[model samples]
Structures are given as structure tokens and as C-alpha cells.
Target: MIADSGRSVAFTGHRTYDGTAAESLSAAVERLYGRGFRTFLSGMAVGFDLAAAEAVLTLRAAHPDVRLVAVVPFRGQEERFSPADRVRFLRAVAAADEVEVLAGGYRRGCYAVRNDFLVDRAALVVAWYDGSPGGTRYTLRRALARGREVWNLHPSGGGLAIRPVQPALF
Candidate 1:
């Protein structure tokens, strides 16, 4: 079994999130923390990954036990990123309690490797997917297949709404 498989949560979402995403994720982090979840796994991608990690760090200020784990896909993942984006990513990584690099070098499936790694180590997944097929969708499916509780924060009526994924056999 993966480490922290029971006390951990993972995050996934689209890169383009609405303005309400930060608030929505903050509330979700607090709720999960109250439920005894302390370790959070973030894929460390651009959108939801960054937002969720920041939210966790914000919450950690009040709850010292909470941890932020940055699951970087591979070495030099930020090489092609803009300077500002790279700075943001570094800040998140520096603030993380642990940084797990899934691969020593970049490969075709590095992203999938990272996503699966996060899901494998987590019991709950908090996502902000907009129903588009991609890494987020794949991670969500994997999380559900593993019987993980998934809370999807989707935009609705100009705000975010929580939709929990029902556990089902694949």
C-alpha cells in the first residue's frame, strides 16, 4: 500500500479556474482538515494544483499538523515555464513539507506517473474538473476506481458547487 494512504488527500483540476476557485478550495481544505486529514498530495501542475497547495499552506498556519506534499512529475518540469510561473511553482515547492519527484528524467507518461502516484497515496481526492478529458479526468477516474472519495468543485451559477463522486466498480 502507498504511504499515508489513509490520512492523505490528493488534488486535481483544470489549469483555467474561475475567480471563485480559491475560496472554494479553501473551504474544502478546512472541511477535510476537520475530518482528520493532515497530508495533502498535489500534482504541482499549473492550475488546481497550485491553488490547492496554497490553500493547504494557508490552513496549515492554523493547524500545524497539516502537510503539503508536492508531487513533481520529473526533473526540470519547470524549465519551459515563464519566469513568473516558475517562481510561483518554486514557492509552492519550497513551502511543501515534502517534494516527491516521480521520475529522474522526463518521459512520455511522467504526468500520468505523478497523477497515479498522488492517487495511490491518497484516500480522498478534491478536484476542480470541468468535465474535460485530460490528466484531471484520468486522475479522477483512477481515484474513483480505487474507491477514493472524490469531491468535485464545478462552476455553477457563477459560483462553485461541490459534487461528490459516487463509488462504483469500473
Candidate 2:
């Protein structure tokens, strides 16, 4: 996702860990931050969500003004987080300039609904996709349909490749 001044961006992706994919995602976040993005919205899930939030915090040390917005799908989603992971997540949320929870509890399909909330409010989306048909893929498809620019990070051999989509010129 291309960074725009005073606009927030959202992130979505698989909750599975892939080392190369994680590194690639960090690079993507750094690139966006360098482009003047100051606010990031993330669902605070495992894998990609945690990774993205961590990256944002690391960047914040350098860009003290950068903000990480935790857009949680429900309360106690942090219960699923590991002790250390939960600590980090809580720190991110406390340090966050803003927080928004889309639902009160984990309803069926709540994650997808949360994704839609993020997409609806974001100027762009940064997604990690392994070409699978899951919530992240569904969110990306929705973003495309709505003409939102997306930056998809796909895992390659021990690394990541970025594919960015721009709004079509009429």
C-alpha cells in the first residue's frame, strides 16, 4: 500500500509462520513508513498480525510519531496470544495512539467482518497472501472490487516478493 499523508492503512494475512515471509513483511512496512505513513491498523492476530505490529513498533523507535492502531475483532482475542506475545501485543495497544474493536466477542465469521471494517476505513491495504482462498484473500478481493490499492507480499524461496495494485486510470 502506498503511503499517503494523514491516512491510515490496514494489514491482513495468514496466521501461519513463514520466516522469509516475515522478513519481507518487515521490509514492506519500513518502505511504507519511509513514504510518510504514520498510522497502521492491524487485527492483532497471530503470525502476520503479530509480525506487522512488531514491525510497526520497531519502526516507531525511529519514527517516534508513527502510530499502531489495533483494530481487534473481539475482546479476549489476546487470550489466544502466548504469554510473551500477549505482553508485546498489550504494549503495542497501550502505546497505540488509537484502538478500535469491531465486535464484542468472537462471532462466527467475525474475523472476516473485522477485515471488512479495516478495509472500509483504510486508504489502502497491505496484505500477505500465499495465493490461498482464506480471509486474507477474501479481504484482498474485496479491496480490489472497491478500487483500493493493495500491496500483496507473497512468499518466495526464503524471501518475499511484492505485488502492488494501483487504481486503474480511466
Candidate 3:
């Protein structure tokens, strides 16, 4: 059970990024910790999700109360990952405080389902979206529709500055 949705954050982003994203993301996670967020949810995807999970783990050294929750979309989602990526994926999952696998096998739209699950439980979302249409954008829209605040960590948006994407006025 999530301790507090109000204090929980979900991470979503592109599968690839420049070298600068990791450092900025880490700093963003640390800042969020300072802002009283304790429960962090990761989609367990290859790039940003794994990086976000790792950041949370690193932050635990100084803030042990922080928690990382890995929300996997399916049972063998990591099977397609390269060997090195699989290792990184496993390491993050092993270190997570909680794991929630949404499906026993892969299915169409499982990722959307997983995104919905994360948004349902989080009051905040940290996205590395570049505004292109994709899973990251989908997750961002879902979060915004659910009234969760979003912080875009994409370098194009501005480095390490907590920019909150306000929900649409509609």
C-alpha cells in the first residue's frame, strides 16, 4: 500500500537522453526529497525510469526514509533488453522497496495501463518529455489529466530547475 499519494512521485521519460540528463535527474530527485516527497514510483523502463530508480537508491544514503517502487508493465518486459541493460534493470528492481507487476505477460497497451496505475497513485510526476508524441508524452498527459503536478527534466526545458507544468484550464 502506498503510504501517501500526496507524497508519492511517478517518473516517466524517453528511452534515450544525453549524458547531462542523469546528473540533472539525480539533482532533481534530491531536491524533491527536500520537498518532502518520500515514495517514488518507477516504470522500470530502460532509460529514464532506470536512471530515476538509481537516483532514488543513491539518495537513500542520506535520506533513508525515501522509497522506490518499481511498477513493471509485464512479467518479461526485460527479456528484450540487451544483456547489460538487463543487469541494470535487475539491480534497480532488487533495490526497490516495492515491486508491482501489472501483467503476467505482455499485452497491447500494457504500458498505458501501467502509466495509469502510476498516475493514480502519485500526486506528482517527473517527466523527461521533449513534447513529442510517445509514451513519455502519454504519461505526462495522463498525469496532467489526473491533476498531478509535473516537473519536466528534459534539458530543452531548462536544466535542473523545477518547472511545474500546470494542468490545462479546461
Candidate 4:
């Protein structure tokens, strides 16, 4: 649950990556914290989702009041995660102040619908997209259309840097 003054930020992005993108994501989370965000919502997927959740948990060690909410697409989805990632996903869900599964099971097009749910509920979105055309891109587009703030952390074939862009201002 989000505090009255705190903003809820959801995460969406690619599920495959090299090491550089992963590090960039960690830095982006820290940047969000510095900007006064207190709650984070993650879809609990394998790649970017797991990475974002772990970053939030890591920040919790220092900022114990920060909350991580697992917005799962469906129950038992974590079972498909790799052994290490599965452990992290379970930890995230266990440590989260709130866990909401958008659907009872994996229905066709459910992940995309789940992403939309996250986008609708969040005040901001932190995405690690590699310019791919997929669910993450769809979520990013929706976030922009809703006038929500979105911070893109993907490298544009350049050095790793945090680029914060206001979709509404664009």
C-alpha cells in the first residue's frame, strides 16, 4: 500500500539483457529514491522485474520505511523463474507490504493486461527498455498517454547514464 504522500512507481522492461543494462537499472532505482519515492511496484518477472525488486529490497536495508509491492500477473508464476531468481522473487513477495495478483491464472494476453494495471495505478514508471517492441514498450506508451512521469534507463549505445524524461512535458 502506498502512503498518502508517497508515490507508487511501477517497473516494466525487457526480460533478457547483458550485464551493463542491469547495473544501469540499479543506479536508476537509487536515483528514484533520491527523488523522494517511497513505494515501488514490480511485476515479478524474471529479468527486469526481478532486478527492480532486488534493488528495492536492497534499498530497504537503508530505508526501512520504503515499501515494495509485488504486482504479479498471476499466482505461481514465480515457479517458472530460475532457481536464483525464484528465490529473489519469493523474497520480494514475502517482504512486500502488499501483493496483488492481477489474475487467477495466465490467460491469453494476460501479461499485457497486467502491465496496463500497473501503469494505471502508478504515479511514475521506471523502465529498462532496449527499444524493443513488446509489453514494456506498450506500458511505456500507455504511461506517456496518461501523462505519468517515466524515466528510461536504457543506454542509447552510449555510456551508462540515468536519463529522466517527463512524458507529459515531451
Highest-lDDT candidate = 3
Winner on TM-score between 3 and 4 is 3
5-112 per-residue lDDT for model 1 (tens digits):
799999988777644567667888888888989999988887778888889999999999989999999988878667866887899999999999888889999999
User: Cα lDDT for residue 96, model 4?
Assistant: 87
* lDDT of model 4, residue 100: 85
Which one wins by TM-score: 1 or 2? 1
- The residue-by-residue lDDT of candidate 2 on 70-128, one tens digit each, is 88889888988889778977887887767887788888998888888888877778877
For all the candidates, what are their Cα RMSDs to the real structure?
5.2, 5.7, 5.0, 4.7
Model 2 CA lDDT for position 59: 80
Q: Candidate 1 — which residues are off by over 4 angstroms? A: 1-3, 156-170
Could you tell me the lDDT of residue 35 within candidate 1? 90
- Lowest lDDT sum, 10 consecutive residues, model 2, at 161-170
**Residue pairs whose backbone atoms clash in candidate 2:** none
Model 3 misplaced stretches (Cα beyond 4 Å): 158-170
Off by over 4 Å in 2: 1-6, 156-170
True-structure lDDT of candidate 2: 0.74
Candidate 2 displacement at residue 82 in angstroms? 3.7
| Full candidate order by lDDT, most accurate first | 3, 1, 4, 2
Per-candidate clashes, comma-separated = 0, 0, 0, 0
List runs of model 4 lying over 4 Å from the truth: 3-6, 157-170
Error of 1 at 133 (Å): 1.0
